[model samples]
Target: MRFVFGKQDLADSARRAEHCFLLTNGLGGFCSQTLTGGAARNDHALLMACTRAPNVRWNIVHRVEEELTRNGAATHLSTQTFAKGSPEEGWQNLCFAQVDGLPRWVYQWQGVQVEKELAMDWEQNTVALRYQLENPGDTPCTLTVTPWLQFVPKGKNLRKTQTFTLRGNRVTAAGLDLTVRTNGQLTPCPLGWQTLYYPCDAPDGRRKTGLTAACLQVVCTVAPGSRQTLDLVFTLEKTAPPAARVLRQADRRCRLWERQGGFRATAARQLAQAGAAFIARRDSTGGKTILAGYPFFEDWGRDTMIALPGCTLSTGRYAEAKSILETFLQYEQDGLMPNLFPEGKTAPMYNTVDAALLFIRDVWLYARYTGDLDFVRRAWPVMERIVAAYRSGTRFGIHMEPDGLIAAGQGLDQVTWMDVRIGEILPTPRHGKPVEINAYWYNALRMLAELAATLELDGRDYAALADRVRESFRAAFWREEAGCLRDVISGTGQDEQIRCNQIWAVAQPFPLLDPGQEARVVATVQRELYTPVGLRTLAPGDPAFHPVYGGPQKERDLAYHQGTVWPFPLGAFYLAYLKVNGHSAAARRQVAHWLTALEPALREGCVGQLPEIYDGENPTASRGCFAQAWSVGELLRVYEALERSVTDFFDHK
Candidate 1:
């Protein structure tokens, strides 16, 4: 899908920043900047390289500034925000901005129009930006391209230890090597600590300073009435800059992403390509990993399992999915999956309750889609250990209760995916038998039972355990007065707050709720939690509901699960909607309309991707990560679901 922007869209800083574009290498490195070709965050870079595959990342080049000189008048084609305001009004010269395969920006001034395209190699830590000048007015112009270098670790500010030395076209700063190769005259420029501001980081209560140490200017003269193109290459490696042919090849690599996804619908196709950005290959281990989000967040186990189906299965990347599962299987501790793979040399943290269960469900779905029985048999041993560990009680006091439902968490541990713990306060303290965990628990048991039977193994025990869990789950979580399942049944009390978590009861492949109960749960969720983009975390009627998600760190964390709208949960809502409505034509039509409402977001925010969240009250303004994994994954999953029904309709006819 094409995301087109005009002059008016560029003039507004907030609007321009909201519409960001991302170009990623399969090794967890990426290039991101505003549509106006400006650095919006410290993480917005021309070459954010993965020193270690998918984890140890460093922001190499923050941005590239383009200056065009017409006669004596010079126009800066780059925009930046200082401690004051953006003095460089280059955005006014922007004629159009779009990203079909690569990010392309068109700038017109006097009669000179220059189209700048940014693309990266699919597997290399290299970024290439080509500027082709169309000077129809017959005016000769000198175009200078200078790349701003921010040689520091990702998500960190450049400190006093920062050093930059320029030799010819090569610049080395703090052990990070960057080579600037261009057709134009390269002049080494040693700049020290150029302070850049990040308006996006203020709400999250982070240091907003982006420090750049140096820039290398590539000066070239463009002849009038003729198309003159200049190629600028930035790489972490010592190799020379690639030729213009590699630029076209990079475009092909991007297009191949969409063709491989095999989705005919516009949103699905766009999201499928966007989903490809998160599936990075491990450089050290040679396995696939899923990045949680852009600009921040590394590979996390929970996000990986939650995002696996949409990012891989829906996009028809089954081998990558298998690799991802195997990668996490190697990191499994006790019966729990690692919560996160810490950057650098830190050990993986295993503190989550749902990732392992979600992993089982993902494995079952993977086999069902690919019909890979052998793979299932191979993964069966790991699944068996995960189930046994959970049943006997693993980390964080996770074990099956006498009531047959799983109980977990104690002290300061906030598990079960509502896991936002700020200091001693847990925003959504679901520290006991969370409704969704039990739903996944039941689903996992049922899947294991079925898989065992299919493989001629003992299935009766698992089947009995699943049946017992379902009965206990209904009794413990079903709130008769509320007309919906309770959010969590804990030692403290049953949280009766209407939450999106209960949707899982009817949404899972092996549903636990009865027909009437499922309909009630779906209707309740639709009435209270549904939004055009996603489902609200909490109902508006709740006293704890925080409509806006902003302010300091504590405020943002408190509001995170209070009332923020998460697009991922909408996937479950859609499944529940379809299940209750019996996959009817009317339900499909309504689901299609809801899906259509999210289409404009493809062009509006984080171009070709969806945001992580939106304000509970005003959802039109997207907050949090501009490009989220589960956000894109869940949307793709729902789109695939609707597409399957359409296919079935034709087949029955």
Candidate 2:
């Protein structure tokens, strides 16, 4: 999808800043900034290079400062927000912005039209900026581009002055080397530090201002009524490839990805392409992994399992999906998957209870989608270990109770996805049997039974265990008063909170709830937590519900899962909604209508990508990570399901 914004769209700096664009290199490195060509967040960079695959990133090139001079008249074509006073306001000259294969910006001022396009090399830590300058007037125009350098690690602000060693066109600082290449004339004039402000991060109490310096400059001149093209490439490699070649390679890869799913809808096709941003290489495992979110999150176990089906399987990336599953399986310990691999660390953290169960479900899905029984046979031992570990006992007191319900979490360890801790305070403490955890547990058992049966293994044990889990789950968590399942049930008491967790009971491959109960659960969620963009974590009227998700770290973490709206759950909600309604024409039409409400969201936060979350109360503004993997994955799954439903409906006719 070619997303184009006009002058009117770029008129408001704040709105334009919200409409950002992101480009990833499948190595966890990315280039992102606002459509106005300014850095709104400290993480926004021209080259946020991943020195190590999937993590250990650094901000090599912050941004480029562009100036167009026509007949001694200078027009600033770059925008930067300063910590003090007003912004640079170079957005005034930005006439057009387009996000196609590459992000392009066109600036027209005084008969000089300069179109800038940015691209990143595949699997490499390199970024290239190409400029096409046109001078229609009788005077020659000069375009000067200067790159601001930041040698700090990703998300770290440059607090101290850096000593740089410039040898030829290469600048070395902070134990990192950056080679600057340009087709235009290069000048080694170092522009000193400037404090840039990040308005979007002010509420988080994070470092909102960072210092950056211009280490190199490029100058290109176009004659009267003539056109000239200039290329500025930055890399850590020994030599920089041609900017045009990098752009072509990037564009070709994008086209190949766009053709993957053959999705009928334009939104689905766009989402299919956007989902590729999260699939990154894992050097530790020497396999593929799905990143949880861009600019903040890394490859997480639960998130990868939740996102694999849509981002990979649905997109016809079966090999990568299998590789991702294997990557997590290799890190499994005592039937537990690693919650996350810490940045710049080889040791994986095994703290999540749901990731293992979800891993089993993903394995089942991978087999179901690709019919790869050989792969499943190879993974059978790990799957059996996971089930056995959970059934007997595992870390964090995770074990199946006498009644066949999965119990997890001990002490202050936040195990589930709502895992947020503020000092010693656990805001959304769901240590006991979380509703979704049991649902995933039940589904895992049933999937293991089905896979075992398919592989000619004795499956009666799993089937009987699944039966017990279903019966015990209904008896323990079902709440006739709320017409839905409880959030979490513990020895203390049953936490009767109207949360989105119940949606998974019906949304999973093997639902534990009856049809009538599932319909009521969907209806209750629709009435209480449903929104156009996502589902709220907690329902309104609850004292603990936080409508707005903002403030300092403590306040934000307190409100993180209290009532934040997460888009990933909406995928499950829609699927369950269709399932309970029997996938009728009316139901399909309603689901399509509900999904249509999200089309504007695609253009809201990250141009063509879905955001991690929105505010619970007024969800017009997107919060948290701008580009989320599960958010796009789930929605794409729903879109694909809807398309298949329509196809099957017509095929029968």
Candidate 3:
């Protein structure tokens, strides 16, 4: 799906800033900027290179300053926000902007038409900009492009004392080298220490200003009544590829990814293309991993497992799915997976309780989709060890109870996905047996039993354990009074607030609740937590519910899980919705209609991508990370589920 922005869409600077575009290399490096060609966030850069595979990233090139001169008249073609002055309103001259495979912008002013297209080289820290200048009038035109440089680690502020040296077309700063290649003439024009403002960071009390320097400029001329093409390329490597070749390779890869899932809907195909951005190489493990979200999050264990089925398996990238699973398995300890691998750190943090269980579920899904029994056989022992560790005990006080229900979280550790700790305060403290964790536990037990049987091994033990958990879960979690299951069950009491977590009990591969109970759980969730975009963390009537998510760190953390609406859970909700309704024509039609409601959202924040979250009260505004892996993954899963529903209904009919 190509998103085009005309003059009207670019007229509003605020809205245009919120609508950005992203282009990622396979090594977790990306180039992103607003639709109007401005850096709204500190993370926005033309060349954010990853020195390491997925973590050690540096912002080498922040933004390019472009100006077009026609018959002695100068028109600024670049937009920027400065610290103390008004913003450069170059967007006024932008006639059209589009995000197809890459970002393209067209500026038409005074009979001079200049089109700019940008792309990043695959698997390399390189960015290319191709300009096509068409001068129809009797006067010639000149296009001047200047690149602003900041050789700092990703998210770090550039210092005034930072030294930079330029020689010919090469630049050296902070012990890093950058080679500039352009068809136009290169001039060494040094403009030092310019402070740029990031309006998006101000609300969160983050560093809103950053310093960058203009070290080099490129100039090209187009004669009257003729068209001229210019190419500008930047790379950390010794050499840079041609702009046209880089663009062709990037477009070919995206087109192949878009066709991978065989999705009939345009949105689903676009999401399939977007899913490739999250799958990146892990230098530490020598394998592939899925980034949790773009612009902030790293490779998280729980998020990777949750997203693998849709991001890789659903898109028929089976090898990547297996590789990601193996990558996590390489770090598994005591039957527990690492909660996250910190950026630039070799060791992984093992703090999550659900990642290991979710690992088993993903393994089952991999087998179900690809019919790869060999992979399952190799993974069986680790899966058994995980079960054994949980059966006895693991880190953070996670253990199976006497009644066969799994329990986790202790001390200051927030084990589940709603994990947010402010100092000693644990906001949204779901320290007991979280509803989704147990749901995953039950599903893992059943999956193990099935896998054992499939592998022709003794399966009685796992089946019996699953039965025990099923009986214990129904007795412990079901809330007869509330017509739904409790969010978390503990020895202290039941945290009976309605949340999106309970939907998993019915949505997992193996349903833990009975038919009537599943229907009631689905009904209660739809009535209380459902929104057009996502499901709220907590119901509105609860006192702890936070209607909006904003402000400083503390306020955002407090509302992070209190009531923030997340899109990932809606995938499970739709699956359960279809299951409870028996995948009838009406039900499938309703789900397809609901999925269509998300089409407008694709063009809202990041074109062709879903965001990490939205506000609980007013969900129109996209919040948190602009592009999220699990959000796109889950939406892909939902589309796959809808397609399957259609096929099954017809087959039965």
Candidate 4:
């Protein structure tokens, strides 16, 4: 799916800056910049290297300042928009921009064309930038590329370094021993600290001022009626000179997408390829880990489990799925899965309540998809340990209640997924039995029982436990007055707020609710919480609902789950909707229509991918991470399911 744009698309600077493209090297290193030209945010860099395999990232090179000179006339193809004013306006000359496997841009002035394309090597932390200049004018054109260097770690502002060493075509810094080489002629330039402003960082209270240093300028000249190509490579170690091999890697990636059931549709293919970016190679663990999102977020256990099926299983990377599950299983603590795997550290944080239960569910899905009983046998002991840990007791006061339902959360620990705290106050305080947590618990128990039965092991105990939980769930969570299940059942009473969490009851495999109740839950959710982008975290009528999700950290935390719309839950909502409607042709058609809203979204914000969230108000605008793993993964999963239903219908007919 080539997301193509023309001059009209790149005419506006703000629009061009907002629509960005991403390219990743499997090692978690990546290259991203706006279509307009220069880096829009501090996170946008030509080479954001992962010094460690899937963690410990640093922004080595920020952006390049390009200039085209001919006959004593010069034109800048790069723009830097600071607070005072932009020093250059090169966006107007940008003729076209397209992003498929690679992001390519073309700038034309007086019949002279300069094209820039970026690609990253799959195995190493290397990025190759290819520049082609075609001179159709009477005189020759000289293009000078001065790359802005910032050897700062992720989230840290660039600082002035005392040492800037340049030798021939290679340049290295004091603290950062980076290698910058190109085939074009390189001249040593005066090194000085240049101040650059980041508009995207200002809102987040991050460092808006960036100090960049340029040590060398790469110049390539094109004769009249001739074209010249230059390859510039950046890597930690000097290996073979780039042969434009990154394009071959990009081709292989696109082919992987086509093989992984992506040839069905444009959106499916785009999502399938986008999903692959999140599964980074874990060099430290010798396995794999799912990055939660791009530009921010790390390898989170809960997010990995939640994103496993859609990212790996549905995307036809089953081995990667197994590796991820295996990696998480190795870190299981007292039957609990780690919520986060901190960078540069072996210690894991096991604070989330749902990750363990979700891990069991993910394993069941993995076995069902691959039909690999051997892997299940290897994983069965871990699953049993998880159930035992939850049944007996675990950290954060997480244990099964007397009523057969699971209850989690301590005095200060917000263990559930809606976990957001502003100092001492919990915004979405789910201290008792959360609706989705119990649903996951019931599903985990039933799936474990099924797995045991499939393996011909003792399964009656888990089956009985699932039965008891089902009975307890129906009796406690179903609120007759509201017609939907309560959000959470606490000591005081049931909180019947119109939230999207209850949809899991009907969405999961072992649904606790009956058909009529399931239909009612879907109806209530669609009526109140559903939106074109996704379901709102809270209903509009609720007093606690915050329509917008912005401002300081405190204000953002207050509105995070109170009303922000998240795309991940909509995947479950569609699943419940399809199940309730019997997965008929009408249900399939409705699902297809509902997905049309996201079709435009693929073209908008973060081209060819979905955003993590949006505001809860009408006309929902994309916010948070530009390209989210589960957001794209969930859409991919649902699209695959819809296509499967259509195929199944034809096969039966």
Highest-scoring model, TM-score = 3
Q: Write the per-residue lDDT of candidate 4 for residues 1-653, one digit (tens) a residue.
A: 78888878767766766788888888888888877667778888888888787878888888888888989999888877765544667777888888876788899988999888878888577788888889988888899988888877877776663467877655566455666667898788898567777766666566677778888888999999999997788876566347377766677776677568654766788888888888898766789999888888888887888888888888778899999988987888899998988766568789999999999999888887888899899989999999998999899989999888999998889888898877899888898899999999998988898899999999899989989999999999998777898998876442878899999888887778888899999999999999888889999999898998776678778888988999988988988888888888899899988988887888776777788888888635577788888888777778877887633211110
Model 1 stretches astray by more than 4 angstroms? 84-86, 137-139, 190-193, 241-243, 646-653
lDDT of each residue in 1-653, candidate 3, tens digit only: 88899879867767867888989998989999988888889999999999998988999999998989977789888888899876778888998899887899999889788899999998899999999999999988899998999999999988878888999899999999999999999998856667898887788777889988987899999988999999999999888899899988988988999998899989999999999999999998899999888788888899999889889988999999999999988888999999888755456799999999999989988888888999999899999999999999999989999989888999899899989999999887887778899989988888898889899999888889989998888998899988899889865443878999999988887778888999999999999999878999999998989999989999999999888999999988988898888877899899899998788999998888899999998899888889999999988988987775433311110
The segments of candidate 3 whose C-alpha lies over 4 angstroms from its true place after superposition are 343-346, 491-494, 646-653
**In order, what lDDT does every prediction score?**
0.84, 0.87, 0.89, 0.82
State, as a TM-score between 0 and 1, how close model 2 is to the true structure: 0.97
Per-candidate RMSD, Å: 2.4, 2.3, 2.0, 2.4
Could you tell me the TM-score of candidate 3? Answer: 0.98
Q: lDDT score of model 1?
A: 0.84
Candidate rank order under lDDT = 3, 2, 1, 4
Ranking 2 against 3 by lDDT, winner: 3
Candidate 1 on 1-653: residue-level lDDT in tens? Answer: 88888878766778866678988888889999888877777678888988888978888888877789988899988877766554566888988888896888888999888888878876778888788888776668889887777778888777657777888777888787788778878987657456788777755787777777655689888787777888888887768547476578877876777776677888788888889999998754579999988867788899999999999998889999999998987888898898888765778898899999999999988887788889889889889998899898998989989888998888899887788999988878888899999999998998899899888999888899998998999888887777799998876653878999999888887768778888999999999999989899999988999999988888999999998999899988987788788888899889988888887777776888888889998788778888889998988888887877533211110
Question: In candidate 3, which residue pairs clash?
Answer: none
Query: For candidate 4, what's the RMSD?
Result: 2.4
